[model samples]
Target chain A: MIWVNTIVQGILLGGLYALFAAGLSLVFGIMRLVNLAHGDLIVLGAYLILLLVTLLGLSPFVAVLVAAPAMFALGWALQRYMLNRVLGDDILPPLLVTFGLSIVLQNALLEGFSADSQRLPTAGLASASIELGAINVGVLPLMTLVTAVLVIVVLNQIFYRTRLGRAFRATSDDAVTASLMGIKPANIFAVATGIAMIIVTIAALYLGTRANFDPSVGPARLIYAFEAVIIGGLGSLWGTLLGGIIIGLAQTLGAAINPEWQILSGHIAFLLVLLVRPRGLFPRAVD
Target chain B: MTLINASSHRVEIATSASRLAAIAGFVIVVLLFAAPAFVSRRLLQDLFFILTMLGLAQCWNLLAGYGGLVSIGQQAFVGIGAYALFGTSILLGVNPVPAILIGGVVAALLAIPTAFFAFRLAGAYFAIGTWVIAEIVRLLVAQWKMLGGGTGTSLPNSIRREFWFTETIQDLFGVRAAASRDILAYWLALILVLSVIGGIYWLLRSRRGLALSAVRDNLQAARSVGVDALRMRWFVFISAAFGTGMIGALIYMQKARISPDAAFSVQDWTAYVIFIVVIGGIGTIEGPIIGVLVFFILQALLADFGSWYLMILGVIGIAVMLFAPRGLWGLFSDRTGIQLFPIRRRLVRPMISNDKREG
Candidate 1:
């Protein structure tokens, strides 16, 4: 019974990890960019939400709504102006540039927020939990899981059913050809990054509410997100969820056995998966 | 038909400017070696810091610049090396000096498994994969109770005071115990920087260096020419790991304290090294040398500002990446065509003989 409870909780935690990875997968699928500042950007989103909540005296959910559009614009401008210029044959420039951006964001946040860990002021949802027979699960984790599913579903619909999605696909397939076809690859990239930022804001809502976070936490989040993307196979959104679940399960199980092994177990699981499947469990056929 | 071959054939490795630079460099090194005799203890410590960082920057440049592997997880090797030094000395009672060497060897050995896993990913994935591996190593190290787990451990005082050169430095230079240790560590750092620079320069001049450049430029073309691209990359990666390990071990030995977090700090070891390389020049040997100087200057100027210092560095790094990807030294080298350490093979023939033959 205890083991079952741990597994169930792990699955729920996986949902948050999936949310963390969704934006990363979306951007990578379109632009082939592995933003080193990605984790920092998520932290940035959380801060934006925190700011909205603190200043406007808004609820956490309402603050996310306010933060999302603002984050979208920031991502769009960042992509169009800074990141877009660095994307090319050489991989080092984008990687190094984003690394610098990560440092900038981290330190700027540190200066602004004073390195003190902050949590979004939740009324009571953060502490609320539900009983399901033998297992009791936190309401926030359940909502996060549900939101993660909805996000992935909506993302898939966008990829398959929307015009902009086609442009994203077209641009990703071959930017030169897409540009000749009047797609404006740069604009498509900006839009993609903007959408990814919106997803990041959603993830932030949960992250800020669920745990205390400071500026330096970005890289650790990035590691988890990167691991999810890799395990799920690059360019596959649904795969990211499964990858996240696997990691979440590993962590909880490891913690059950020995609490100190929780984080290490996730990494060990990642390494094991990498060893077995070098291209990830479900690598995109085209890539 | 008997061909009258009168043209003298020679391949010049260095230009006249480079020769002069080499002579000047030798003089500067000699003066630096004599610095403990006259310089302030604080200044020596700073120079020691600069030299170790320079060594790290050079090794990273060799991997990312020439080998085409942009790794952000080099802290894995650094941490592992430091930990290995502490473990061997503490557990096995090995002498601290030899333990440093053992740390390097262990790091190199560890790189084999690391490269095995990291090599599976291409480009940016590979970078993150190495980072995850580093995190794993850190977490695992933190579990070892003997090493103080996550809290970390310090070198024994007996080992610190009784190390090989402590007495020799005190006897030779007549400095105090702590100052003598600093001078000894400083000398080691100096030796490390010189060897790494010299070694990388020599490697870049070899036939393998040609292949490395070829692979970096175009991997497909290199493979088409039977260059064995993967082999070249593996060689460079392993060699870099070895050199980086030695430097990491030496760094912690000087500190005499080893903590998992401090040992595996990406900000201190990897990020700053990357900044130095990108702002100096990624693919050139001279870039890190210039980059380290700029970094030292910035550190000296901005050390008082706390987080603002790092923010400024980040902003400068981004701006430099955007505006000048080749770095400050690269810009200068482009305009003046002066290579302080020239390695490009130049074919030369006696001008008169060649002209006569052509005529």
Candidate 2:
């Protein structure tokens, strides 16, 4: 029963990891550039949601709706203006530029938000619980898990079924070729990043409502998101969720045993997985 | 006769430029060697840090610039090495020197496995793979109980207690350079830098260098010419790991301590090294050295500003990537074709004009 509880909490935490990583996977799948600033963006989205909830006296869910689209625009503009310029044959440029961007974002957030932590007001919803047999789960955490599943489903639809998705796939396959086919790769990239930003907003909603966060928290979030993306095997969205669960489980279980083990266990799990399957659990065949 | 005259003038300019570059390189090396003799204690210590960064940049350059692998996780090896030295000496009861050697070996061993996984990834995937491994190691090391879990572990009692003062000798000739921990570290870093560059210089001049360069320029063509891409990549990757590991151990030796966060800091190895290599230029043996010195000086000058130094570094990194794509050393190399440490053979033929007579 205790083991079940540990696993349950682990699985629920996986939802957060999944949310953090889905946006990253989407961006990476479409554009071969990894945004080192991803975690900061997620934190920014969370802060945005927090602002909306606090200022407008809105519920967290309602605040997410408002924040998501706003983040989308930010992502679009960021890619079009800043990130797009750095994508090229030489990988160092993009990596260096993004690293600089990460520092810039972290520092800018530090300036705007201050180093003091801020959390969204969840009231009793955070304490609300759903009872299942002998086990009980926090309503907020359950909702987060559901949100992650929904985001993945919706993103998968956008990627496979939608015309926009086709354009994204075409662009991902070969940008120059896609441009020759009249599909503007840059616009597609901007849209992908925008969509990723919107996902980030969702992740932010959960993060803000669930725990205390400061500006410096983003890089750690980035590590989780990065781990999930890699563990899930890069291009596959659904696989990312499993990866998140693995990381979440490793961490929570490690924490259950010895609190310090929490962070370390996740990393150990990540390395063990790498040792076994270098391409990840569900790596893209081509990738 | 007009064409001949023009060619002759071009020859004169190229020869003079090469001559000037050789002179400059010679002077720089001499100055660098003489730094410890002239500099104050603090400045000399700072130079050690600069040398460490230079070593890292060079290792990164060899992998990314020459071998065409863009790794963002070199810090994993660095952290591993630092901790390995600190851990081996304290935890395993090894001497500091042996501990550092073990750190290098540990990095190499780690690299073999990491390469197995990372090599599966290409381009962006490869970069991400490296990053994931780095984070994995960092996290695990921080968690391991024997190593001092999350809050972090300090160096063992033996290692901490072991930093003996260098015997002071008053010599008339050259101050005999008082040997202290910092000085010792500085000398170690200097020797490592020289050896690493020497090894790289030799590597680039060998047939293997041709294969590596060929792979970097054109993979398919290199494969057609019988250059095994995977083999070259693994070799370069392992070499980078060894160099990075040695750098890590060297750093820890100076501090005489290790913290998981500091040991595994990608911020120092990946971010700073990338910044240095990018500004000074990437791909050349001497590029990273120049880059490290320039970055260190900037860092020192801007140490007064709390966060402004980071902003400046970011701005420089961004600017260099945008405008100076080939980097500072690259720009220098292109302008004059000066192979300061010639790893490649250049066919230099005197220009013969229609009117110019052969000597």
Evaluated on the second chain alone, the candidates' TM-scores are 0.96, 0.85
Task: Please state the Cα-based DockQ of model 1 relative to the true two-chain complex.
Answer: 0.92
Per residue, candidate 1 scores C-alpha lDDT tens digits across B116-141 of 99999999888998899889998999
| Candidate 2 local lDDT, residue B42 | 84
Kindly list the per-residue Cα lDDT of model 2 for residues B77-177, writing each as its tens digit: 99999888867776677767657778888999999978988887677657767877887788777766777765666665546445443333223223433
Writing each residue's lDDT as its tens digit, candidate 1 over A103-146 gives: 99999999999889999988998999999996899999999999
Q: For candidate 2 chain B, which ten residues in a row score worst on lDDT?
A: B165-174
> Stretches of candidate 2 above 4 Å error?
A53-58, A272-277, A281-285, B1-27, B91-99, B143-165, B168-179, B335-339, B342-344, B350-359
Candidate 2 i-RMS (Å)? 2.3
State which docking tier applies to candidate 1. Answer: high
Every model's TM-score? 0.98, 0.88
For model 1, the superposed segments whose C-alpha errors exceed 4 Å read: B1-9, B353-359
The lDDT per prediction is 0.91, 0.82
lDDT of 2 by residue, A205-262 (tens): 8888899998878878987888898889879999899999899999999999987568
DockQ (Cα-based) per candidate?
0.92, 0.56
